[model samples]
Target chain A: MSPVHLEAVCKLYRGRQQLSWRRLLRPQPPDPPHIALQDISINLPKGNVLGIVGRNGAGKSTLLKIVAGTLAPTSGLVQVAQPVAAILELGSGFHPELTGWDNALLGLALLGLDAGASQQALSDIADFAQLGSAMERPIKTYSTGMVVRLAFAVTTCLHPEVLILDEALSVGDGAFARRSFERIMQFRRDGATILFCSHSLYHIEALADRVIWLDGGRIVADGAPQHVLRDYQHFLDQAPETQTPALPQAGLARGHAALEQHRIPARLRRIRVNGQPAGQAVELTCLQSTLRIEVDFTSDPSLPAPGVGFIITTPDGRSITSTSTIADGIVIGRDVHGSGTVILEFPDLPLLRGLYVLAVYLLSEDGLLVYEELPQAAELQVHSPGPELGYVLLPRRWLPLGNGHAAPDCKPSAHRYIRT
Target chain B: MRGVLLLLRRLIRAYGQGFYQPWQLALRHRHLLRQLLGRDAIIQTAGTHLGRLWLLLGPGLQILAWWFVFDAVLRVRPMARFSFLDYFLPSVLPWLLVQETLSRCLSLLREVRSLYERSIFPLAILPLLPLLLVWMIYTPLEAAVVAILHGPQAALAATGFMVVLAWLLLPWCYIFSLLGIFFPDGAYGMRFLLTLLFYFTPILYAPQMLPENLQDILAWNPMATLLQQLHGLIGLAALDLHHAWYPLACSLLVTGPAWVLFRRMSIQIREAL
Candidate 1:
């Protein structure tokens, strides 16, 4: 049997509609129940990783909650293998006033660990969270990152049969993120079924074997990660820009509290593309126009300058080309006050036709934690003439054909592709 | 005979199906229950220098305040052989159990909804939380007080009666918890109602102190039946068989329906939240 099987699962939120006494005394029609999920079905075999991706309120968290047995579905069947541990919300199931050690025991018990196994799990959590003596202190005193670390540790330490994470993979960066990434990888190696949801398509594509894209509480795409993610991005691209801009990844706001104790990390102050404002769309000739992106940032004088990245992607959210300050070994010089603006210039851009999106990201001093993302910073509309179909036009050298003799109109240059 | 046989069959069937679910969930999550209760015990007395002693001491202070009003200031005494504090002590001990459990039940589900409802802790087990916590705190205190005042025999009797009283209050735990969740107004109203109930019962004054009609009306109170059972068992009041039927009948009448109501409202509670 598949480790996780869901059949025709539907969740309708009929919240307190006719429950009001005032409504009962003088009755009016109740509002329609919100359909959080509809006709969802999946059969995930053991050791498989399934990724859920969707827009905000697209019911990603709702689906995870149901499968994890937190919320029962309104109708239909949900059969998940037992020993399912889920990190639905950060620091959930943890009492703030209780010591982290006590909370871990409680969390393990809720996840169905008995007395014998709890001791080992508790030790593992203490080690994984690296809180050390902080484990003896109440959770209220720990920073948010420490809480997430503890929650993540307790949830994953048991090697649950089905591991569920909702926007939790962005646990903190540097050693802990890498440690968490390795632990999740270990869960996969140990044949644990992982159900992961995230706004980062990069992580989803790298980690998920199969992906399900939810739209309007229904499964719009489900298949191989690349195929489904492409389809979802295309769907989003075709959609009008009427909806509000999506919220940045939730982890972007994390670590600020801890950082406050030390120094302010780098943040995107301003950006300009080819002398145009970052908000407006800029047109560029495929090979004739130079794509110049200038970025300004400010950070604490004591801290080193933060790294910056420039990414260009298709309208369907697929990255075609990327570069960064750290990758090129370029150290941004800081002024006396540790604030500076640096310009990145690319002469004669070779991007092909069609509309594209570019985003500038700011990383911490360690260059592992992505502190902020200026998503959709600008639209780069590349104009390429002739019949070229794809993201980039690679430079080519056509060797002499027919002993260096070539026709004038259909010359050796005729076979040579002109990008502009 | 037919009705008795029918009750037997229903009891057996309930035992087979939904009746034991709460118990099973309790056993399944027993460790979590221990941790939660332990945490509550610590938090209740943490900031105080006295620590866990405040479990008994805090309630002791409240009773001291009452003693100043009724015994010292008002100079009230029961017509019975025992002093007013002696008359008040045994009954108030049981009343403390009811007050603590019922009052906490008003916010029990609300407080732990996020902690348990969204996770594996069965929501059905929530109503039992207040009962168990209060029972652990007050049951021994009642027996200790009885032993100190009366004798060993009455203390033993108080222990047995408190256990029985705890069982009888189980259904009300579920009932009040549901009421609190569905109607928040019930929580505010229940506090005032409990205070009125304290005065209405014979815990503070003798029944003869009130008019005969008021005494007649107070006898109809279901809580009075519980208090009467406590007094009779400990050899303070006459062991009246008239109030005996209510405790047993309330348990049998309400246990099944309360469980059903809890199960029925589980979905609604999640949505409402």
Candidate 2:
């Protein structure tokens, strides 16, 4: 069996409604509304740390709660092959009126330890919490950091088969955070499966073997940490641009287009433009009449300049602009034949709103073109600008004459004034 | 039947651990309970000048007010055989103990819910603490009052009877403690119900003063019977040993179910809190 399996899980929160007393008196069926999770499925192996990353209100905590059995899923099943413990919120079950020693024992008891076992564990937790004599004082007198430290100490002592941490590490000082990380590593070493929810990218990268990206209450991507994180970042960057520009056709074009031929001897794999792969690049419309060029290039150690550049122009081949790695003060020093990607972005186009061509070149520092694309390798059309004037407009200010003053004659200047 | 047995076994085990292992736990983490009690006592009397004395003073003043109102304002006389103070003091003293004990018994779990929710401590002890505090305060005042109104023999006898009654009431205390944790509104409901119970009890009015039919009804109140036993020892009245064993037997019978309810509800209480 999978260590943890969430099959077609769904969660819904009931929104409060105002009902008349008459309606309240006559009971009605609960409303079907507010779906937080829609058919999510996950199968996690034992002893692997999984990090869940999501924007606010994306249902990460709800998913964790369901996994921890603190909450039941509205539909579907969450099956765990091992015992689970959660530090969902630090000091969640702690009593402010109880002493630290009492809370430690209480936390342990709640985790299913008998009194004898809890008593035995309390000393270690107390030492780890480092409250010293303060442990005798009521928890209300303890600082927030002290509370978190005590909670972390007690929770880590449980030795659970599956440990779920939900943003508990966000509290405490840096030293305490470091200590928590060390304890978590120890837990991992004890062959426990961990599901950690955090906004700390560094911690996620350092600890998680796999990462799940949640968007709009759905699992958008799940894979090795680096790959999933890169995809999530790209998703974040592209989502807003796509929404604002109505770029569905552009998306299709970017997905459909393919690289027919290439002269440069570079291994280019998994090329994506505008967040869509190169094989399906045809769907993308170059909205800004500007092309974003990226290529994976590898070179022999002897080659000084294994650089790539691109030129954008009208279909008539009037070159608009071009730049190269050598011109940008980058030096290719080794024949290491190692691979790296180069990116060039053209912010705006001077050409009129019409079809344009893109030309590509791979050259050395001596100006020898190792590879070149003829006049029009890629073609894109720039749609007519709406009512807005010029390529870009500035918000201008004008002052009117006061009542007693005569108005000075003024005319539009030869040079258009643009606000920075 | 098996589930019931299993639940009982578990409760027994839990209670045994809490009672027996407290010293081991306390020794390791010394002064934890003391600190909790101290904080509770201090916060309870923070703004008051008397501070911890309020624990004693508040109840003392309450007794004084009750005495003044009943004797002066109402001009009420004691039963023919008993003086006003002699009759009223014994009844009201125990009544106060029962009220204070019962009201606080149910609230103990709620007032310290935070402690139950967070720590590995057995929650049973939390409810016991409040009851213990009330007992400490009530016991001394009870002795002093009996000594002043009656002779040394009567005072010692009354104290002995009160101690015995307290022991008999342990099961009820435990039941209320658990009820406090499980039922969020248990304390308020108990208070409202106990208000009616106070009148029915023989605290404010002697049972003999009621009509014969009503006397039978009043005698049904376990609190009234307990008070009568207490008053008898203090020489304020004759001991009515007849039907005395009934309330004791009834209390014993009720205790079994009450304990079962407490055990069953404790699990749910942990989750609810």
Candidate 3:
């Protein structure tokens, strides 16, 4: 039998509306309701680990609570083949006044153990909690971390058939987290079906066999970990970034055409990568061409040899390229203004489709750092070329093996490709 | 009926595992329940200087206040056949026991809501703890009161018969304990309803004080009937077999329904908590 089967489940929350005296005089219909889950169906087999990921308020917690039997669905059925245990919230069943040992017994009792069995389980939980003499003291006196430790110990001792953990691992220190990770692995190895919810992508990637992405209280995507994570990341990227003021006239033309069409007022407009806008100044995309980066800066005549530097990095903080005016042999001291437009043109962007942040540095003539922007201004996303593979594409030439290859006459091409 | 009997037997087995043999579970978890009760007592007595003394003192004051209200303020006549204190003590002590046990059982779950969340603690034990505490403290106090008001005869009668009756009906305490966990508001509402029940019962007044029709209705009050039987045993009133049988039968009738409700609700109480 499957560990869990949820069929045609739907949860609806009724919204309350305040009625005025005048409105109350007449009959009024109920306010519209919010649907937390709609016709959701899921089947989890034994020994499988499923990770649920979603933005805040996406009903992931609700789904877990339903499966834990902490909540009953408004409609439909949830069938479980075995006894299920959930760490829905930390310290949920522990009595603040109870000692750690007492709580361990209580935990076992809740699992349907007899008194003798519960007593036997207490020692194991006590050992795991490692509170020593403090286990005899009231739990209310314990620190938050201590409470979490005790709760975790008691839960892990249950040897539950199906373990559902909702963000429980995010608690505790580094060492405890490592130990907990080991314990989760052990539980998995023992063939316990585990459902984990976490915002940590790394943990999900490492621990989960499958991932379900929830959006607007609905399952937007569900599949293998990598596939679902990719979809979720894309969903996050497309979500509206910070609302910005309108853009300036020349700035509007240089900005992405998508930005130019946005109804934002000229002054309020700001550049955004995913959902967050650039902190510094805005960099404009070339009009009608997406090939390279172009910077337009107003130069101050007082500052000489004003050097400009541009650094591009992937969203995960991998440095793609860093170039400065000095490296390009542009002497800012000789220029009339301390600052001038420094354009770094790459005829072919080497970066694969991914989100990238740009950083710009403005320097004085004597190579004194005047102003530096680590990820200078805003974020940019290079959209995925459908079905493209490889982290980067390199421009290379192949010549015939023999040295006597005929020389071919060629015209000066407008495009130039560089390989590093 | 057979299925119910089987389920009852199972429940009894489950409960028996924890009942008298505290060491079976308590040896390991003695620290746990102790800490829970200690913490509860501490928080309950925080602002008060006397601390746990308040547990004894609060009930003491309640008994004193009730004595003053009934003996002094109303100056109501006692039952035609007995001393005022004798008539009042037996009835008041059992009434106090019933109220304390039932009220505590009802709110037991709400008082331990946090403990319920910690998945490790079984919620069933929550209701039991309060009742257990009440039994420990109030049982002795009730005996002391009986001995004081009516001397050795009343004390011996209560110790033998009334005490046994209370123990036999102790299962009611467990039933109410489960009810308390299942419906927190239900406890408060029942407490309020018990105020009306107190007047209907012959706690402060003689049963014959009312009209015959009213006497018949008041005679049907289960707690009153139990009190009458208790008073009769203590030599404060005549033993009315007619009144005695009704309460015993009613108590029996209540047991099945209470057990069913308790078992059914016990499964859901943890979820509610």
Candidate 4:
């Protein structure tokens, strides 16, 4: 039997509506409830790792709550074969006034362990958390990462049949995270069913066997991680446009033929790279190398010297950078009227290895009016030799410091691992 | 009798599960409960030098204040048989227990909210924590006071009534806790109401001091019955069976429905948090 099974589950929360003083004498109608999850069904066999991916308020946490049995669904059946543990939030079940040791025992008791068993489990959690004397102190004094360590240790050591982690490992040091991942792997080896949710696609890709993508309280896609993630990425790329309409076909030639035929104002006709028409894939050669993008478009005759620009953004529509003809302080002469090409080039791009989307736009010469915009006009995949953190990579020179003094032979492995 | 047996069986089968599961969980995790209670006990008196002695000090001060107001200032005679101090002590002890439990009961939702959501632990037993903590602080002081003034018999009577009182208050505690979640202002409202109740009940004066109609009205008030019971136990008043019956019947009626409703309502109320 599957460790967790949810059928036609839905969750509705009543909005906390305030009634005015004038309505005190009258019975106020109850506020409509917000639908957090809408008729969602899921089944997880033992040993399967299911990842939930969604934007904020997409009901990912609500789904995890239902699976963990912490929440009863509005109108459906939830069946779980084994004991479930959910790390919904760090320091959630802890009392601030109580020491970590005391809280740990309470947490275990909540999980249905006897007093002797909970006491026995204490040493294991203490050792695993490596909190040392901090376990003796009240939980309010402990840092967030320490609390997470203690929480993670308690939950993992309990040997739950079904484990649900909802962005629980987002905090904590790298060593603790590594230990947590190893423990999860060990749980998987023991045929435990796991539900993992996070905003980080990297963790999802590494851990999840199946992926469910939620959008506005409904499942948009669910399948193998690779297939569902690709569809989810595409959705994020053009989320505003529900469906991708066909782009108008244009001439193959470059000069007057391609320009004059495209009389439409501020429409992106074609994109080129190094004097060649860039097709299907655009790879950003990321060895601190320069990359150039040429956007060919048409502008109306009346709007002279139209501003052509391109914006580079992440898949989630966060704009990283944008440049326009007005911003660059370049004005076209009166003779150039019908159509033109705007060239945007990056010299030694500092962006780390990741997927990025480029959006091209046409604006009035002053650059205030956006005449047209083509979001996700091009996709750039950066490849790098080393796994780097964040968007940009910084240049560095290694001058080893030995014993608080600059020395040639010594290395900074200890300092470097702290970041990883 | 058969019909009543069936109903009792059904009640046990249905509400008993809700009742037993949390208690069982509490027993299983008694170590945790001890830790939690111990932590709460220490923290209550941590900043003060006298630690835990404040339990006695607080009630002692209240007794003194009441004595000063009724005896010295007003020169009022509440009872002919007993001094005002002796008359006020036993009634006030139980009154304080009820008052403290009611005040804490109103905020049970807020306290449980902090701990329940962090894990999948059954939080059904959490509401009882405050009551137990309050009992832990007051029980010892109560024993000492009863033993000192009224002797061993009074101490035993007070302890016996306290157990009965806890059972009487449990259902209302759960009901108020659930209400506290919906109305965060319920705590303040209860404080206001309990203060009015203290005056209406015969804590500061004897019921005989009032007119017959007022005495008739006060007899129906549950606190009045409880205080009368304490007075009877301490040899201050006769053990009036009718007064005792009123509170017993009222609590039984309230507890039966409250327990069932609390079991059902708590499931949904948790989601609100």
**Which residues of candidate 3, in runs, are more than 4 Å off?**
A7-35, A38-40, A73-83, A112-120, A215-218, A241-420, B1-53, B68-84, B105-109, B117-133, B143-192, B208-220, B244-273
What is the iRMS for every candidate structure? Answer: 2.2, 7.6, 7.2, 3.2
Assess each prediction's global lDDT (C-alpha) against the native.
0.79, 0.65, 0.64, 0.72
lDDT of 1 by residue, A1-420 (tens): 888999999999874563456876898777778999999999999999999999989999999999998788999899999788787886778888789998898888777778788997888888888889999999999998889899888878876899898887657544466577668778889999999899878668878899999988999999999999888877776776533333333333233343445334555666888887676699987777788998877665676688888888766666678888887888889887667777888777878788888888876554545656777778988887657787777765555678886544432222344634
Task: Give the per-residue lDDT of model 2 (tens digit) for A1-420.
Answer: 777899999987664333435446897775666777878898988899999988777888878877877666778988975467677777877767667887787567566666678788988898777779999988899888889989888878867788888876433553354456657777889888989888656457767899998877789888999998777656655554321211112111111122222112332333344443442322222223344666554533333446665655554434445676766776644334444567766544333345555545445443333322233335545553433333222334456667766554433221232223
TM-score (C-alpha) between model 4 and the true structure:
0.72
**Residue-level error in angstroms, candidate 2, position A304:** 36
lDDT of 2 by residue, B1-273 (tens): 999999989767665543334334434443445445555676577657788999878877887887788877886676876667778877787777778888878777767765554333455445445555666667777888898888878888878876766655656777777666545465568889889899898776777778889988876788888877777778778877776786687556555565556545554465555
Indicate which candidate wins on TM-score: 1
Better of 3 and 4 by TM-score: 4
Best by lDDT: 1
With candidate 3 superimposed using the best TM-score fit, by how many Å does residue A278's alpha carbon deviate from the native? 19
Which order, best to worst by TM-score? Answer: 1, 4, 3, 2
Lowest-lDDT window of 10 residues in candidate 3 chain A?
A262-271
Give the per-residue lDDT of model 3 (tens digit) for B1-273.
Answer: 999999989667655543343324434455455555655666666557797899888877887787788778877767765666767766776776677777776776767776554343543345446545665666676677788887877787776655555544555666767656644555667888878888899988888888898988876678878887787877777776676777667655555555445545653554454
Clashes of each: 0, 33, 28, 0
Best candidate, DockQ-wise?
A: 1
**Estimated TM-score per prediction?**
0.80, 0.54, 0.61, 0.72
What are the chain B TM-scores of all models? 0.89, 0.83, 0.78, 0.86
Computed on C-alphas against the true complex, the DockQ of each candidate is 0.48, 0.12, 0.20, 0.37
